[model samples]
Target: MNAREVNTLNIVGGRVIDPTTDADGRLVDIHVVDGRIAVIVEAGGALPSADSVLDASNAVVSPGFVDLHTHLREPGREESETIETGSRAAALGGFTAVVAMPNTDPAQDSRAVVEFVREQGRRAGLCEVVPSGCITVGRAGEQLVPYAELMKSGVTLFTDDGNGVQDPLLMRRAFEYSSDLGVTMAQHCEVSRLTAGAVMHEGSCCSHLGLPGWPSIAEELMVHRDIELVRITGGRLHVLHVSTARSVEMIRAAKADGLSVTAEVTPHHFTLDDESLRSFDPVFKVNPPLRTMADIEALKAGLRDGTIDAIATDHAPHADHLKEQPLDTAPPGMLGLETAFALSVGELGMDLRSVLACLSWNPARIAGIADRHGRPVAVGEPANLAVLDPGVGWTVDRRRLASKSRNTPYEGRSVTGRVRHTVLNGRAVVIDQVAQR
Candidate 1:
């Protein structure tokens, strides 16, 4: 956080579940001073002076979340969302850091643009915004962006998110250089040729509705292709928004084969099915369209079995009128940053620790921010943390949301879990479920 002068902050009576320290459900008190963990005392045995104390009773205090995918829509599309508003939403959702996507007006291809986005996030003083660079210049698939140049700006993740790299040879060349550069090439996994004018998942739902279907094969093909490419090139490849059963199986096998590959699934894919499109609301529409129940089950199995590396929000915010358009013409996305954790906890049926693994440490490592973002709540560590009440229940209200756009699919639906507070770099950015700044 950009809060320069951090006061002594004490968070007491929370069940500390730090995977970094092998702590599971241990009740403790954490003292943050000078933007670092100063002391950690066992519950009921704390004698630490503090300027402010946050009662974290009945809550799980862990490292703050890091989103591998978040669309802040800055630099050009401020009508949809801004860096400040998006960071506010992230803080409320218990995220201390978020990887800002590169699909902007000028595209985050150069150091200047990515630096601008990072500066805007710092100006907001909410969450740490790490801007990802475009894999291709201008997010156009013709030429590769200067990875080495952009890396100087602290961009470790590169992806042409709105579309996949169409050329296999070009992708291979990118992989060859990525390993040497110590960076990751994340693919959108959709071959545009296959998804021309496509709407929802190509299934029975589309058959009855008489609308164009975005086939599952479109994503699976690219996932398989990238796995093979990684097998040959020996570079890190990350498949984004994985949605198909076959894709999950392929990634699991690739990992077994010792390929440097990682994949992430969105909350919408695992929580909602293609059947939700029955209402014909464009809000249900999203890229890598929602799949069948079988696919959802496979996604859950992957997460439980440690096949999926993370649960990224893919938090895209579109303007009001854009999502109000017809399903065929509307943009394929939904507001996700604020609701991803609860949706995952409610739908996955996994234990709280496993759920946190997907939401916190796992994604943090993937985004390459582990040095600061995803760390244990122990002494001498950065004080980035999320305090969660797993037993709490809440419903979404469009007006109450911190996001600038209102395209959330769960507008009135009840969801489990709530972020009680978010501490970013020794500052409590969110306290008792409210953004402090």
Candidate 2:
């Protein structure tokens, strides 16, 4: 399918809530031409004609979401998800951009892999798919990837997502190297030694179920290590999938101490708990496995208080054969992109603007794509926006999701707030909840 070339579009009668520009849910009409915002008029002000009009009544129009962590699983694992399929899922979920993790079959540690990912995204043309480079060569954690070369190829964030850099000296060197290159390093924050046989959080649920437990310290220890490393090297660090109360406290302290650290919490981390593992279902399984209810409260507080910088989906998708295995044998992950907004709005108790801050602008800044995505809704900014109905409720049905995988943990759950339209570079990739291509 060819990319939809939208020349002009007008989003009408929506409550514009651009936190970047402080629009604050004001009723306005936004006009776009040639892939850029042409004008933003008040609700009753005169409007310009356009090739297409999206009626956004009773909706909150804001910058399209930017996910800091998304596993596209392409370059090898096409049966699970390809760049095209993942970008389509992102658009339908109101995302304008997603950072593709570098844990593919061959691993995205080289310029060829990085360029291949970017070119595929350009061909998809649904959303901006930024490729994250692997911190270690082939994600082996033994040696670092070619940072300067990858950075030259436009890769900004680096991570060995499935595995954290375990060697302190190696990680410090990575920090030093990345600092010089002016790029950011993201850590998955798990100490493999402590989680060798773990399947879920080490808590009452795991004890009762006789399942191997993944202790919070496994993640917190790494978080602490990375914080100190960032403090020592003054290199920017992003902690991924923060799942413990202590982890949040440590991040808060790190920020107070002026360390260049940013952290993200997954929707599942803030919404679900280890008790979900009691069902013995694999859908509840995820890396940095869901923690206790106390951890959930802490994550929520961190988000509300600004300690947690963004709400990334970590949208890991696995085929049925892999995801449907017995709890101890199944891979850890869950479908998130499609239900992220609803889960945040219905579960976090945060206002719509605050939610967008985490889902949109903050994440865009973290992923280094703020220039185009997460831009203010004003003249001259790129027309990447999402029209969301904050009051509407919908039940999550796995069969209806855009991703090829059906491993959503929120299946059958009902939640308020849904994306009504998503405009990507002036093109209506999604209108009235339907994907355009």
Candidate 3:
């Protein structure tokens, strides 16, 4: 069941929705040859011969999804996830490419580490894995990594995820350096001082549960600081997993101010609230902890109004033993890649077009992979595509997921819009909701 390159594939009877080329839900047939889209014709138009044919009837075909933030956990925590398993999960979730975060055991600060991650993904043969370099050496938040060397290895995004750079001066200098290198700095907007001993959102929920609280101001402060830093250094900045109403407001204002900034919101931040903490489930314990329903409303508003450019799954995974501990002692994170698209469509209630913009094109632009992964499904384009049955419904089951981790927060919840098939490089990686390898 290994993913081998296919010479030709004929996808029939799907509604093509390529936002980049303004193809709005037109019934069409896509023909792929030699890992590229050979032609696209009307549904009932002239046909092309192929080695394989996929019936995409009643499905929506679009450019494959691109996740700007994904934690693959290779070269470190293989007990939780690896590049192969994560890529399987991603293909099933309709994602053809993911930006592997640099928070591994050895850390992806060196060109050697970044190349290892990329090569491992290639051997896995499931999806395109883009490695991000750590903004600071060893992710220590002090010395900057060899940005130019990492860039030579094809790393376009840098971040010290799981921890923001605490020193303002260091961050400003990093921004200045990255600006000159023409790379984007993605920030995990958290102030360690404010979030100390925090398990859930610093709100009535934490108070009622008698637990430590992570305040919204903690994330907002970093967002505001980074926005100002972007203004000063003239560097590209991307705020990751924005969780609060004020954070959304600040990003909206920053966008209006013409700052070179983009922001992302996770599905959990918009779909679930801190009230889920009443059960004291460690699955709900996430960094930049879940906020109130008011914050959810604001995040949705930001998505609708174009304040949030992408809906990235901060797809963190944890081993069952680690995640099963008490909420206060457990690590913060949850499985996301397998459920991101379904939750984004079912919970946000946005049109399919807007959802794809957040899930596909916008994130591709942010990761600088739009040239290959998120191109329009047209003649001569690379054949990375997802065929989605938007009318289908399914419930979350952690045991059925492709990731090695079983830490999904949406277990047993019903969701709309299942991925019928995923095609990567003219090869079907997932068919009929099943992973090929």
Per lDDT, the best of the predicted structures is 2
Error of 1 at 147 (Å): 0.4
As a TM-score, model 3 comes out at 0.98
Q: Which residue pairs come into collision in candidate 1?
A: none
Candidate 2 least-lDDT 10 residues: 17-26
Models ranked on lDDT: 2, 3, 1
Per-residue alpha-carbon lDDT of model 2 for 325-359, expressed as tens digits? 88889999998999999999889999878999999
Q: Scored by Cα lDDT, where does model 1 land? A: 0.91
What lDDT score goes with residue 359 in model 1? Answer: 84
lDDT of 3 by residue, 1-437 (tens): 33684488999999988775453678999889888999889997887889988889999998999999999999999999999999999999999999999999899999889999999999988889999999999999889898999999899999999999989999999999889888999999999999889999988888989999999988989999999999989999999999999999999999999998998999989988999999888999998898999999999999999999999999999999998898878989998998998998888988898999999989999998889987888899999999998778999999999999999999999998899999999998999999888
Q: Across residues 1-437, which tens digit of lDDT does each residue of candidate 1 receive?
A: 46875589999999988775443679998888978999988987855788888889989998899999999999999999999999999999989999999999989999999999999999998999999999899888989899999999999999999889989988998899887888999999998888999988999989998878889888888999999999998889989999999999999999999998998999999989988899999999999898999999999999989899899999999989998898888998989989987998788898888888888888888888999977877899999999999879999898789999999988898999899999998999999999999
What is the C-alpha local distance difference test score of candidate 3?
A: 0.92
Cα error of candidate 2 at position 61, Å: 0.7
Positional deviation of residue 77's Cα in model 1 after best superposition, in angstroms: 0.7
